[model samples]
Target: MRIILALLSGTLFGAGLVISGMADPGRVRAFLDLFGRWDPTLAFVMGGAIVPMAIAWTVQRRLESPLGDKAFSLPETRGIDTRLAVGAILFGIGWGLGGLCPGPAIASLSLSPVAVAPFVLAMFAGMGLHRLFTR
Candidate 1:
C-alpha cells in the first residue's frame, strides 16, 4: 500500500510538472532568461511544488509514524557543510546555464531529442562522484 501510494504520488507530481510547462527545458530556460523572455510560469510551478512538501512536513510532524514505518526516515544532518556549499554552487551554475535540475531534467527526458540525454548522464555522474568524494 505504501509502495502504491508512493507511485501514485510520483505520477501526480510528474503530471503536475508536465501540465505546468516545467517538463520542457525551453520553458525552464525562458524562466531563467530574465533579461530576455522572463517567464513567470516557473513561479507558479514553484509554488505548486512547495505547497505539498510544506503540507507533508506539517502533517508528518504531528504523526508518530508513517504508513508501515515505526518512524519517519529522515535526513540525519542539519548543519551547514562543504558538501552543501559545493552542491549549491554547482547546482546554481548549472541551473543558470542550462535552466534544469535533476527532477525537471528527468521529466524533460521524454522529449528524447538528443540534447537532454547527455545532460542527464552528466548529472548522474556528478551525483555519483559527489557521493564517492564526500564519503
Candidate 2:
C-alpha cells in the first residue's frame, strides 16, 4: 500500500512537471535568468505547489501518523549551518550552469535522452559520492 501510494505520488509529480513545461531545461533556465529574458511561468507552478504543501504540513502537525506510515519521519534539522549554506550554494551553481535541477532533469530524461542522460548520470554519481563522504 505504501509503495503504491509512493509510486502514484511520483507519477503525479512527474506529470505536473511535464504539463507545466518544467521538464524543459530552457524554461527552467529562463526562470532563473534574472537579468536576461526572464520567464515567470515556473514561479506560478511553484506557488501552486506551495499551497498544497503548506496544507499538508499543517495536517501533518496534527497527525500522529500518515495513512501509509507508522509514524511521520519528518526532518529534525533546525537553524542554518555551514553544510546547509554550502549545499545550497553548490545546488544553485549546478542549477544555474546545468539549467535543470534533479526533479526536472530526471523528468526530462525520456524527452531528451541525448542531453539529459548525462545530467542524470552525473546526478546519480554525485549522490553516490555524497553518501560515501557522509557515511
Candidate 3:
C-alpha cells in the first residue's frame, strides 16, 4: 500500500515536471540565465507549486500522521552551517552548469538519455560522496 502510494506520488510529480516544461534543460537554463535570456516561466511554475505546498504544510500541522506513514518524518534541521552553505553552493553550480535539478533531471531521463545521463550520474556521485563524508 505504501509502495503504491509512493509510486503514484512520484508519477504525479514527474508528470507535473513535464507539463510545466521543467523537464526541458533549455527552459531551466533560461530561467537561471539572469543577465541573459531570462525566462520567467519557471518562476510561475515555482509559484504554482508553492500554493499546494503551503496548503500541505497547513494540513500537516493538523494531522498526527500522514495517510501512508505511521508518523511524519520531517526535517529537524534549523540552522545555517558550513555543510549547508557548501551544499547549496554546489547544488547551484550544478544546476547552473547542467540546467537540471534532481526532479527535472530524473523526469527528463526517459526523454533525453544522451543529455540527461551525465547529469544524473554526477548527481548520484555527489550524493554518494556527501553520504560517505558526512557519515
Candidate 4:
C-alpha cells in the first residue's frame, strides 16, 4: 500500500512538472536568468507549492501518524550547518547550469530521454559520490 501510494504521488508530481512547463530546460533557464529576460513562472510554481506544504505541516502537528504509515520519517536535525549550506550551494549551481533540478530532470526523461539521460545519470552519480564521501 505504501509503495503504491508513493508511486502514485511521484506520478502526480511528474505530471505537474510537465504540465507546468517545469520539465523544459529552456523555461527553467529563463526563470533563473535574472538581469536578462527573466521569467517568473518558476517562482509562481514554487509559491503555489508553499500553500499546500504549509497546510500539510500544520496538519502534521495534529496527526498521530501519517496516512499509510506507522510513523513520520522526518528529518531529525533542523539546523543550518556547513554541510547544509554547501549542499544548497552545490544544488543551486547544478540547477543553474543544467536548468533542471532533480524533480524536473526526472520528469523530462519521458519527454526527451536522450537529452535528459546525462543529467539524470550525473545526478545519480553525484548522489552516490555524496554518500560515499559522507559515509
Candidate 5:
C-alpha cells in the first residue's frame, strides 16, 4: 500500500540521515561554519542528493503517465511571488537556526531527542497560523 511504502521511505530516509552524520546539529553547523572549522562534506551530501533528484525529475518529465494514472499529476504555478519568497526565507532561517527541518526533525525526535520538540511545535503553530490566515 501507499501508506506502508511511505512509512518505509521515511524509515530509510531517517536511517540515511543518521548514518551520514546529518542528524547531529553540531555536524551540520560545522558544515555551515565556513572559514571556521569548515567541513565540505555537507556540500557533498547535498550534491549527492541533488544528482538522484535531478535524474528522477528528468525522467519523470518525459513520462506520459503512471501505471494507473491517466497523466502525471503536477502543479502549475503562475510564477514565483512574494508569498513564496517570504515562506522560503522563513524556512531558510529556521533550518539555519535549528539545523533540522521537518523531515529530519521528526525523524530525530523518534530517537528521544529533546531538542526537536520546540522546532516541531513552532512548525505546527506556524502551519496553523498560515491556515487561519488563508482561510
Candidate 6:
C-alpha cells in the first residue's frame, strides 16, 4: 500500500513538472537567468507549490502520524551549518549549469533519455560520493 501510494505520488509530481514546463532545461535556465531574459513562470510555479505545502505543514503538526506511517519522518537538523551552506551552494551551481534539479531531471528522463541520462548518472554519482566521504 505504501509503495503504491509512493508511486502514485511520484507520478503525479512528474506529471506536474512536465505540464508546468519544468522538465524543459531551457525553461529552467531561462527562469534562473536574472540579468538576462528572465522568465517568471517558475516563480509562479514555486509560489503555487508553497501555498499547498504551507497548508500541509500546518495539517502535519495537528496529526500524530501521517497516513500509513508510524510517524512523520522529517529532517532533524534545524541549523545553517557549514555543511548545509556548502551543500546549498553546490546545489545552486549544479542547477544553474545543468538547468535541471533532481525532480525535474528525473521527470525529464523519459522525455529525453539521451540528454538527461548523463545528468541523472552524475547526480547519483555525486550522492554516492557524498555518502562515501561523509561516512
Clashes of each: 0, 0, 0, 0, 0, 0
Estimate the TM-score of every prediction. Answer: 0.83, 0.93, 0.95, 0.94, 0.83, 0.95
Clashing pairs in 1: none
Alpha-carbon lDDT, every model: 0.81, 0.91, 0.92, 0.95, 0.82, 0.95
Per-residue lDDT for 54-94 in model 4, tens only? Answer: 99999999999988799999988788999999999999999
Q: Model 6, stretches more than 4 Å misplaced?
A: none
lDDT of 4 at 54: 97
- Please give the RMSD to the true structure for each candidate, in Å: 2.2, 1.2, 1.1, 1.2, 2.3, 1.1
Error of 4 at 4 (Å): 0.4
Provide the clash count, candidate 1.
0
For model 4, the superposed segments whose C-alpha errors exceed 4 Å read none
Measured on C-alpha atoms, candidate 3 has an lDDT of 0.92
Higher TM-score: candidate 4 or 5? 4
Q: Write the per-residue lDDT of candidate 2 for residues 1-135, one digit (tens) a residue.
A: 999999988888888899999999888899998899999998999899898999999999999899999998878979999989999998999898898899888888868889999989999999999999999
Model 5: residue 17 alpha-carbon error in angstroms: 1.7
Error of 5 at 25 (Å): 1.5
What is candidate 6's local distance difference test score?
0.95
- Model 1: how far is 101 from its true place, Å? 0.8
Model 5, 1-135: lDDT tens digits are 556766887899999887887877777878878889987777888889998889989998888874445677878977889999999999888888888778777877876567778888998999999999998
lDDT of 3 by residue, 44-132 (tens): 99899898999999999999899998999988978999978988998899888888899999999988989899999989998898899
lDDT of 5 at 45: 84
